[model samples]
Target chain A: MVNLGSIWQNLLASQAPLQSMTGNATTMAGLATYSLPQLPYAYNALEPYISAQIMELHHSKHHQTYVTNLNNALKVHVAAIASSDIPAQIAQQPAIKFNGGGHINHSLFWKNLAPAETPETNYSKAAPSLAAEIEKTWGSFDEFKKAFSAALLGIQGSGWGWLVKESTAEKGRLRIITTKDQDPVVGGEVPVFGVDMWEHAYYLQYLNGKAAYVENIWKVINWKTAEERFQGSREDAFADLKALL
Target chain B: MERDISDSRNQSANSLTLSLSLDKQAVTMSASLFRATPVARSALRAASAVKPAATFVRGKATLPDLQYDYGALEPYISSKIMELHHSKHHQTYVNGLNSALTTIAEAESKGDFTKAASVAPLLNFHGGGHLNHTLFWENLAPASREGGGSPDGALGKAITTEFGSFESFVKQMNAALAGIQGSGWAWLAKDKAANGKLALITRANQDPVTGNYVPLLGIDAWEHAYYLQYENRKAEYFEAIWNVINWKTVAKRFEA
Candidate 1:
């Protein structure tokens, strides 16, 4: 079974970057998700963090494909579910749920995976404010990884690796969380971060080595973006935390 | 296997139980140092049946009003971050979901499966978006009115009983959340199925837990939630969010 220290050490591991997001169709205002979050570095920037070839396909083909499929999937959802026929309506769920979550989560996941070491970039060097927050919680960044990576490596199949907020009796401090399939965090569970470990997500990048992929996820992490998430949810996160013992 | 989209039309009731994360906080419950549990250990499941009437919020999911101001979560969350998450990303989900719904409505009205099949994915994408954002607002609170804090009384006692201590539970849960392989969710649910009536569970996709458990609290482990703050070190982000949990809400939820 997983122990506290081992988990703690892994949690203390390095940080992550941003995920890429693209979209289709337009809005009433007519935007195609124009500002889809981009990678902090070049496709090859992740190199050892994530192979270049894998990065290429992941960003261009895989993620982009999700966007395409997501658009296509919704088109299908329309025709099937509208039927008064029970059978036809029920059949459309897998596509709607799976592809839908894939599209949304992947877009965010891409924004989360940034390529570090981009010299001369203004947002490099994991935001100090965020690091301070990390330091306050886990004692040290290393300790956080020990806990985070241990969790990241324990996946079974096509699913995501997540870092979510926890609830306490006091609601004082939030804890990390992981969800299966497209399961969601409820009760004001602020989503600070997540990683996709589905084979399709990384089989191409690191082959069957999910561990390697999970570990390297830090090298190109986008702390600045995370800082924004933390700062965004801070009031609620701690407001709840302060309520707890 | 064909699944039921009937559930899709129904919106989960706004029964967000705020208070202690309770059973889930079994220690190392320290902030900024959360961990993930492997998805292999738990299957995605749903809360015990407390079925409510079907809710059909047609059109698009709208931007919800925050319980507090955008910057109310300062220190834990930044104003800039809040602005973007709610107004930008979350809104996108609402718009995208509505667009999908409209398309589906037209296709089905025309009795065209081929056309319906074409836009099916958007339903998931936008629907998931609508669902996630709605839940996000329900579980949070303003720091002043018993939102962020620690557990006490019954909530505290329960956490102590299950995970030994709050610290242990937190570590384990953090491990569980960090352990997720992809974008999904981690939760602290009360499993009424068993005698104890509570257990911590995690689900991978946008699939809601469909078993005998009820959600007390959930964390969005998707990167967008924290990539702006913690980067790849998800554990740190997990740990840091603790300072802003809005526990008063959690406690009241548990009592309900």
Candidate 2:
């Protein structure tokens, strides 16, 4: 339950400094113009498993639109912030979210993939900590993949399947979660690796067989990126918990 | 703070016979404050399937009449979107909920708990969809009418207090909305236990905001809500919707 009266009293008590503060600087200042990040490899790089044409369109067209839209929305958002117009700000949210999410997910997706020749089964060596956590949680790498793939296939629409570090609530565990429609994994969960399940991601290549796309994606999985994200998330979680102590 | 559930339920039952009949042009209802009680609750009362307006009241769920013309929210929310959303999308949910409830009611009557348990998801999804959309409709008005301005009176004061300012509140809600990972809704709900302090919360898919709080305003995040008018420029759609926010209706709900 929310105690609005007490909360209002608190706001009034702090109103002096709040009143003194200038136009919503945080909202307006230093807005990042998110650009289309370059794919680490050539369009044809993750071939056989993920086709060149798919990568080209997904990255160049789909991802680019998100970038352009997010930047455009932020301009209005900055003004909404300064004016203190609540409804105006609220109105801009959906655009920022969808486009921002597209940008974030695609950016992460591109980095987390590599050439097919890259070793697919080197999680234990590349990301020892993540591998140990996965092994402890799911018994082994094979079980973890099976679980992850099942979660991915279960998504009902255009979305991403993620392996995230649950750093809050459940704490320091690897969990498989699916977000429909480019919604980023939020609330203290740091994404280690993500698989795009949008039909546009594989329709041209895999046709209706989403499972085949999920299975084949492993051939181009970038374990090194996953390891770094895993290690960083764990460190961040530790710092957050330590602050409580 | 306890609601007179019986009185409210009775009121809903009394209104169960009323149904909207639209012309080919889709002009049928007018925005009036007397439709004070949540139509979502009134919708549930019609689930009895014994109502005179039984065409829509299938086993006890019915389509709510819009208080404004479908074209009333035009330029902000197109008449086409409102028509499709209300007549098709929301109606589908009402039908789904009624069907699910009918199934559950039958199972319960025959002591078939297993069958009842199996259809619970349908109830949660469709029932929640009906409830949320019902609230969604009541929370808007035509800008030319009594809509699109900031809140006033106690609701206004509460907004200022809890959120620092109205702009801050919208900003915070926007941040929350931006973070929902899928098809969902962003809500400005009142927390009864917390002295009516407002809270911003979200629900995934068709899940309703349940327990501890009453939803005062809900912004639908589902693509169907904006995909037609705004397309991928969801920000434009979201920003434009404020022109039709029914703050008076919101204040009334809060005071009750």
Candidate 3:
């Protein structure tokens, strides 16, 4: 498992202006900004399931805008804090939450998707433990898929559907949940995988056929990543952020 | 605009007293803050500048009454979809808008800019939703009444000039509606910045048409607007909605 906590700690430490002045090359010059993470595979890697057009726009345009906005919001937030302007600080919160969650969710989303027909796409083969856990919870993999798909369709507006692992006393327990807008899975829950239900995610290819989009998403789901997230700590699951830092 | 505000104030008078005090407190605070600190003046100016008109007065945004029955636009838009869209979806936006405005007012009164700023997106979203739906309800009439057919006079001439022909305008508007990336609206608006020329525009996620464009007609592109009746075949919904479009309302806005 990746020791992402140390990396995160180091990132926080590197944010100090002193660290930049001390010739710490690893620290970003001046304020550290969260940059967009590169996709694990080519843009067309998930083709037929998700079109090249959708992938290109979703990543290069939509996700990139979120990353850019998040960095800008963070910069403004830091300035607001320094000046002790409470309203300015509060004003920045929504943008921070929206763009930050967008970045985090998209980062997790890209990683949890693999090229169709890959070993990672085979749930039982790549994720026996997670498959077993899913079967235990929802009776079978097919049943779990049905339940998750239903949750996805049930969203009224812009949102995401997530498969999460409960933390603490319910560590191994799994749940399917939906979050409105760009809300991330919070409260110590580990997001095993998330399927973005935002129209931009599928609209270019599927048009209005959301059900078909949900059905085909399973074709590209990376069970290897699911199993890894299920078995490891939350830190391990979010180690993708290290690249952005 | 003054008449509309007065009418809305009269309609919401019973519920206005509590919130009116809150608004007065907020206005008073901003005025005092304008004098007290130079640093806060810019923030307050920013806050007021982007603040929606609905937040200024009249307590809360109440759901407007439909002139016709929910089933009035039947055969085109189902009664079921109309009911849910107006009552459930639009009501949610109204409640959210009110709550966000109240939060902002209270926060500003206490000099908690953080709290006021935090609710800004909610203000934009719900306020836009309320205003859009209110306009949308008026933009439709029972087909037997003023709905359907083609616009006449200046609005008709403007549409022809902007989009070639009435048929072409309808085709282009439907295309615009279909091409929307997410939950949003496609609008036929008057561009105040360009000498009231007609324009076609789309807003993502309940963003009100503001700053130069006056939305004359808007077609919601959200799945909920059509999913119950049309399902995934939203092209059908887009086509059918025109049969119920109140060209009179569009013309009124255009002429205004």
Candidate 4:
């Protein structure tokens, strides 16, 4: 396992007096930077549900922009911290949250999807424990799906819909939640799975038929990942990000 | 601490003096303030230091009144959509812009550059939304009046030379509108750098057209613009909007 804290210390050490004084926010050689994760399945794997064109652009164009922007913002943040520029640090916060959330959300979103008709896409076969928990909460698997779909369609603008496992007194309880504009699920909630509701997610193939997109997304949902996130700790669910570290 | 206190005093005094001046001047002053980059703004601040209590007028943006009724463009654009789009969405942007500007001014006075800079995205988003919607209202009229049909003057001749014909221009504009990946606007703009040649462009989210182009006609491609009326068939909304294009306004902008 990689030492995440040490990696951050190294990042700070590299941005010493010389680099900080120059205000050169560009990534230096040998510097650790956040990068776009490779998709588990081929771009065309989810075809007939999500088109290959939509997958390619969503991953390459949209997600890559988020990763690039997050790196740039983090560099500026590091420089600001070195200078003790409170205002500059505050200014970099929004970009960090927005781009950082975009990266985290897209990274998780890709892992939680599978090729249509696969065993991983079948809740009954791949996610028995999660299916049982969901059925217990919403009364049935179909009811949970209906409720989740309603939450997805309710988003006014750009956002995401998530199924999360509660970590409060109601530990391990299943819940459906929605967040606006690239906001990730926060606090102690384990994001079992999420669906991107940004127009770019479905606009190419679905056009303005958002309901159809919502309906079709289930066919590609990776229930195996959902079950794993449901059963594991938050650290286990976020292990993919740690791999990048 | 002494400098911060003096700065606040000067800012208040400037505000008081601005209140006594003409409203038009106040609007112009605020517009210029919003346009300046952080570096240019600090330079402006340094320049103003010589005259400690000079004019630093901050103005609030108000919603522009529509010449036609909310339901004027109905059947094509529903009264419900127009009312929500204008009263709810556009008004939110106007309020946000005013609040962001106020926050920046207050922050700058207190030497809180962090707060000032943090409000920059709100200023950009709401500012662009306010300006885009202001232009969009004027770009429409009831089909019964001076709406739809091709231009007949120099603007008409230019359209023919640039995009082949009026029909082709409409087709191309619709194509641009349909191609937008997310919430954005598709515009028919005059490319200032290329000697005012007509061009079709798209801006993602509420980003306004800047640099070398003067936007002449813009079609709102955000789902909010047509989702309630046309639903999934946004291609219909794109096609239907041409019936109320207000070509006279486009021609006036072209000539200007």
Candidate 5:
């Protein structure tokens, strides 16, 4: 019997969109060179929770460095190839990996947050479906937040805590996973949302207070964007499985 | 340039056909050359890409020379930390590895396989520690002039291709390194089996990246590496170390 599902997947994948510049590293490099993604809101947008100063430096200074470095590395890589020096070319992997990951992660981090609702509240404003999913997964929204915060603080050095959907599974399930340094996970699952735990993400105002940053970030989470990400993941789950298979 | 583009397009077409050939042939679905998600197609391309091995020579263990002064990586990694780490910590591993090797050689001469097996753990721990540190030192440069630069050439493209952008790669490395509990090392490794697929991996203690994975760079996550300068503030230490990374050495390793 012809596996129509597989055929559809192969056909779709071959013609699959660049996924735009949604911050996937591998795809970004292929579609020309990567550029720094602009923040959706102003630097002071997530004030009280995330400071304007932190946002400005993170976006302009740190993130820009990654973009600049990545371009430089690519140039060196091109020259290395031209010279036929394979070793020299491969040695540039770390620079590309580090800066590339930084760009990809920060690009997503900017969109993960938004200006908190007025009157200052501590509550989960996730979309209805996402709220329901969180409740189903952890019994309650607060429970999910608590677990997520704990995991975020438990990071020993620098890294990220993610709320990702395992799209390749038989069923799409949300899980909290952490990656060290600038490593980004793609291909296996679709990332619904991610938080950068690197000190640069919060060290300026939060100082050593990772717990505060983790707890407060919830106030500014872009629930609409998250819901969109969730919907996209669900649609792509089958395609992901086909690719993996 | 147009010719190169056409050549690459042809190469990609050939590879895609080869990939379909390897997959379960329930049906032959031929599609236009334009089809395929860039990321997903890259994964398929990886399956058929050339895998290169990083050559390493096993010889007498000795102290590796630092290209810059001990104080070179200062502020990020203090001179105190560098001096102690290299002279004391790494030296201990080198000595231990050499000693273990001597015992193993003696055992082999005596045909005492059991004796050789007994000291195998020591050899791996110390030998891996030695090798890992060797790569670690080479990967670092003085933040002053020599270090803290972006990657270039093939190394840069590999990072962009494998991880997306240099920043994304850094974020992954930082996150993975921070999450590592106890003493361990975080690696930016090239998977030779999957056509030099660059990936971030972590190994506890002194475990080496053996088998099909070749390590391009390693960040030491042990407290001793930064405790003197950053105290319990591991984040600061991790953040600062980036300012001193020797991307050139890393690039060279990748090209190798």
Candidate 6:
């Protein structure tokens, strides 16, 4: 049965959305939220490879919109509960979930990207530790990129690219792999490197031209961030497999 | 059971959920490896790792090996069905494939399309047979693991993007297969048109849905595959077979 006292209060309300900006732990009664995150890098920095117009639209319009919808959904979610319309509340979950996640992922995405202005650090040489790992196992970095890119470009449609770690039967060593869509290798493979190939990701700047964007993104790739991801991925992957041994 | 973690590859039960994170605080990067015994491993390794020796069967192909045992497909497929299908039906295709290939090679060497044109049907039948059987084994799982349901991860995402939901994909495949009146197989080919990688496609019959698609997942909708057990119940077989789907293999293929 409906426990009007406890269930209504709890069900009518939702947990706070996880946003780093709200530094304080205090809650705002019904539900607290954060606003759209401004881009750390200027609009025009990416240039011809990625235009300022695209960046402005992508960050300001696309991303900010996700934030707006997320907040709007939460508000409706609260009203639906207060009115006690279970169906209305139930139906709103997916929009809330998708927009909320979209907001979160895009926020992180903005921070990861920067303009291709000055010299950008890329995986000119895969980091030594990761490189040594790949060399010892897969033979050469070129071969690794070929195999990895094969999986990355293979994605059928709009989705995030992933670099997953997996163990081959012969080699107990960890190696990176690629996967399509929302699948993250179920948390085993931390995303050390990625490129969002979805049309919305680069359509404005690169248009239907995927090849150009992929080629250009390499120049602006933040390899150091990818390296950190690789480090974190290795720490968990090897030891986790050892348990089976 | 508590102290000793089991070998994941041989995991017979379906509760196995492949995750990248375990309590050990490790990054996950694994798919289920099914090779348990050295013998199974050796044969599989030979089959999988045999550097594309893929004997191009020119005409009607045949069943290769059960790997486990001829009786292995028992219960689901039955030894009676396998014996006849393998020894009789499949053997016929193998013999035919060899003949067509030899004939084609001779014609090509002699620069004669006239002879090869006549042999086109033979190549389609036999080549299609070989391709189908080669892919069949790769698609199936043992009885314990049968009943492979919808895919997850990147595989699931692709299927969803390409053809709505997983159930919808199955409906399309089933409809496409059912539309094949006489004899043929159903396939979910690895599509590469988008990113020059894997794409899912279905071929009608002895026609290998040619071009490029890594034959990652397949099903023998031909009556010969299940008429013995279900007898005109192809739909039932399709439903039952989903349980034994070697998702781990499919996942690995996608990852590869």
Candidate number achieving the greatest DockQ relative to the actual structure: 2
Which consecutive 10 residues in model 3 chain A have the weakest lDDT in total? A1-10
**Per-residue lDDT over B1-256 for candidate 3, one digit per residue giving the tens place of the 0 to 100 score:** 2233333333323322323223332444222211222233445566654443333432445677788899999989989778878887788887887787667665754568798878767777776787778778888998989889999999999999999999999999999997664478999988877999999999888877777677789999887787667755679999999889999878877876
Per-residue lDDT of model 1, residues A182-238, tens digit only:
433333545556776654555444543457777777776666556555555534422
TM-scores for all candidates? 0.43, 0.50, 0.53, 0.53, 0.45, 0.38
Q: Scored by Cα lDDT, where does model 1 land?
A: 0.52
TM-score of chain A of 1: 0.66
User: By descending lDDT, how would the candidates be arranged?
Assistant: 3, 4, 2, 5, 6, 1
lDDT winner between 2 and 3, please give it: 3
Task: Name model 4 segments beyond 4 Å from true.
Answer: A1-191, A195-245, B1-56
Model 5 Cα interface RMS deviation (Å): 9.2
Question: What CAPRI grade goes to candidate 2?
Answer: incorrect
- Candidate 5's C-alpha runs over 4 A off are A1-31, A81-84, A118-126, A234-245, B1-256
Give lDDT tens digits, candidate 6, residues A65-114.
Answer: 66677667767766665665666766665556555545545654554465
Instruction: State fnat for each of the candidate structures.
Output: 0.08, 0.18, 0.10, 0.03, 0.00, 0.00
Candidate 6 Cα errors over 4 Å, as ranges = A1-29, A78-90, A115-120, A124-138, A164-189, A232-245, B1-256
Which digits, one per residue and each the tens of the lDDT, describe model 4 over residues B91-187? 8777877788777766665567898888767776776677677778778989999878888899999999999999999999998887654578998
Model 4 over residues A47-92: C-alpha lDDT tens digits? 9999998898889977888889777877777677667676686676
Worst 10-residue lDDT window for candidate 1 chain A reads A16-25
Docking level for model 3: incorrect
Summarize candidate 3's per-residue lDDT along A1-245 as a digit string, tens digits: 21333223223332343331233322322456778889999999999999887788789877887789877876776666456565675676666667777888899999999999999998999999999899999999989999999999867568999999988746489999998777766557889999999877886666556799999999999999999999998878787786576
**Greater-DockQ candidate between 1 and 2:** 2
DockQ-better candidate, 1 vs 3: 3
Per residue, candidate 2 scores C-alpha lDDT tens digits across B1-256 of 0132222222223223233232233221221111112232353455454332222212255788998999999899988778878998788787777677667655544446799788767777776777778888888999999889899899999999999999888778777776665578999888867987888899888777666677788998776676556655567777887889999878877777
Fnat computed for model 2: 0.18
Candidate 4's docking class is incorrect
Ordered by TM-score, highest first, the candidates read 3, 4, 2, 5, 1, 6
